[model samples]
Target: MARMPHTRAAAHPRYEALLAEWNELLRRCQSTAAAQEDAPDPAPYGRELLDRWGEPQRRYHTLDHLSEVLTRTTELAAYAHDPDTVALAAWFHDAVYRPDRSENEQRSADLARRALAEAGVDADRTSEVVRLVLLTVIHDPAPGDADGEVLCDADLAVLAGDPASYAAYAAAVRDEYAFVPDADFRSGRAAVLRQLLDLPHLFRTPYGQDHWERTARRNLTTELELLEA
Candidate 1:
């Protein structure tokens, strides 16, 4: 019976679905925290995050991207040590996105820390969520970091999409940085592609590596060449 935020975006079809999922995830994670008696209802927080993802300033990091990441995280849940926590991390990963900012991941992690603690989640689980959120900054989870692998692989799955889908993702990213000059955008984008390409393996999970690594590599390489050309 939590009151959803008073916002126009709350009327979107998927808003209801995501909110339900968010509430369920909070319950599941909090249950592992031993079920705090007076934990606040999580609907309001979910509404706030949905509103942020639907913000006009965002192009690529929209609600659709959030949905996709959540879906992928669920698919890769079996590989995570704490699946619910990894799913929670996916919720906050891009919750504070702004294409102009370089500290989005850190900021998002801080936000998760404050919000989860306020919602009565335990220190250890909240800390795990924060740590996973920060992992998206480089998408480089260390060896044997199961939760990190799941979250980063889910977030980066867009890179392994079909050619048309990858092209759309690239275009949407450009739209997000519409303020940057073309020359600056190209160089910056190329650097990003290079860094991702240089990773030992773009995905650490067996499922992610078997299904996505080659396609992601090809897509990133093609985009990098286009930028340099």
Candidate 2:
């Protein structure tokens, strides 16, 4: 595939590190895929994926979010069934994001299928990647699904960040929904928060439960209060 022009600068100081990690993950995925079939190199696709994540209209679902998820996936790697697949899912889960649309996850999954197929990834691995991407939609994987649990937890790890960071995340989300009226946004956001709060468990993995459950709950409750006020 042809590479797109790279235009996004590192948003965070650690962005370079994140980029390195992303490249490594893509390399692993492509290597495994290539082992079974004649696959194109993943470097071009990696550049294109980064470019998509850097699109200006994306406020919350930008490269920063991808970096965070990738970081968390690394931290929680031990719990994954196939860490490479989980990492790939993190890269593509929001690759085709649009805050105004409901088909983001489905579209992203479809993109994953096409890209993985073109890269000559075998049916099984590509299907796993697609399944993992779709799991991000409802974030409710069946019990004992280790990779699914790990990916879901990693994607939501931001909710467990410190107060300042959590506030920034909430604000960024609001900015993404800038087109919506305040009342409508508040109502919709509150509903989402409530659903999360009502969940029996937010982070499914043991690591997430041990480290992030409490903080995530606190952050969500605080945000819900602010939204209500």
Candidate 3:
């Protein structure tokens, strides 16, 4: 069995229920989004593709990613200018992840918009969430909106997590892009690690910085050295 991290929230009844509800909602959201999509839905559809990929499955983009994003989103939500929208965006952030596809961001955004529309969330608010979701695809070092910043920080929070979680994340990412030749993956991974190194801090939120900044640096230094090797 994989060694899971110890989290206070993991065993809490409220959190367990939240996880169950979230999974159910995600299933419905994906279906509704596909039905309402402007472009023809992809053959496998995002949900099916995710299911087929299997759990953990040596893939970075999976339920684990979504769960972590949500966990961190909640942690950072209180600091967000628009917590609700940030939370919504987090739920839809990786809805359309495909290792080989470049348009995953747009597809993910569409999915968020469709579900938000069906849920009768405010039109303007949904638009903002969609915009934030799109931002993750082509990340900007500086996020413009509070919700965007909050979501952005939450997505990258893994880099700043504890050493154990950070190590697992690194391994998960390598497994995710396992199909790529090792040399190519190393080069690309190095560039990403370098970018994080250039950042003043990996996380945007003050709380995140305080909690994860130092650890993230430690992880980055180790990762960069390995990549260079």
Candidate 4:
């Protein structure tokens, strides 16, 4: 499989740019009532999520990762039923990430549920956003889940990165789990790679299936071999 260039997620954005992206997405998709005099400002929520992404504990799940998925999602927006809605889910998917925690996705989904409702996102869209955030826990979205397919495919696109980019991704994941011993990390990492390899398909969108699948599998297999070796 021929490798592709890295995702723009690797490109770091200025804090202001990301904040503006969030604010714009929120306002564009916000419920009609969100514009009322009593409505809470959405900017603050965007800033808070950015702050969490910038936290000292994060390595791989940083703002760079967020931008990459957002960019990829935008590129695949043609496949989504509601692009901005799925975009919002990408913002909150790792908003509450903590490397040692197993419940980060749940926590992130809860955060989206509370923040979006308070910020005046419509109930139905908010629910869908929450559902998408949780979907990352299992990168499989059922058939015809257009929005889910876009989000999941964008999130996992890092797997199809060129060798240097994939190496960086692997190194960053190891850095995130720096607390774990070498042998333990090797076993755990190998298990994760194996699980991904076991999946019938690494991507769901037609574009993803055609473009990312082979490269992603090759990258994952190479990394798995290194860990087991």
TM-score of each: 0.94, 0.91, 0.74, 0.93
lDDT of 4 by residue, 95-167 (tens): 8888899999999999999988988888999999999999999898999999999999999999999999999
Model 1 C-alpha lDDT per residue in residues 1-229, reported as the tens digit of each score: 1334445457666889999999998877664444647667787778888887787888889889999999999999899999999989998998888888999999999989988888778899999999999999999999999999999999999999999999999999999999999999999999999999999999999999999999999999999999998
Which residue pairs show collisions in model 1? none
Per-residue error (Å), model 3, residue 6: 27
Q: List the residue pairs that clash in candidate 4.
A: 9-68
* Rank ordering of all candidates by lDDT, starting from the highest: 1, 4, 2, 3
- Which has the higher lDDT value, candidate number 2 or candidate number 4? 4
**Per-model CA lDDT versus the true structure:** 0.89, 0.86, 0.67, 0.89
For candidate 2, write residues 1-229 as lDDT tens digits. Answer: 3555546633545556666776676666665637666557666677677777888879999887888888899899999999998888898999888888999999999999998878756678789999999999878889999999999999999999999999999999999999999999999999999989998899999999999999999999999998999
The positional error of residue 204 in candidate 3, measured at the CA in angstroms, is 1.4
lDDT of 4 at 86: 92
On a 0 to 100 scale, what is the lDDT of residue 186 in model 3? 95
Misplaced by over 4 Å in model 3 are 1-58, 138-144
Ranked by TM-score, the better of candidates 1 and 4 is 1
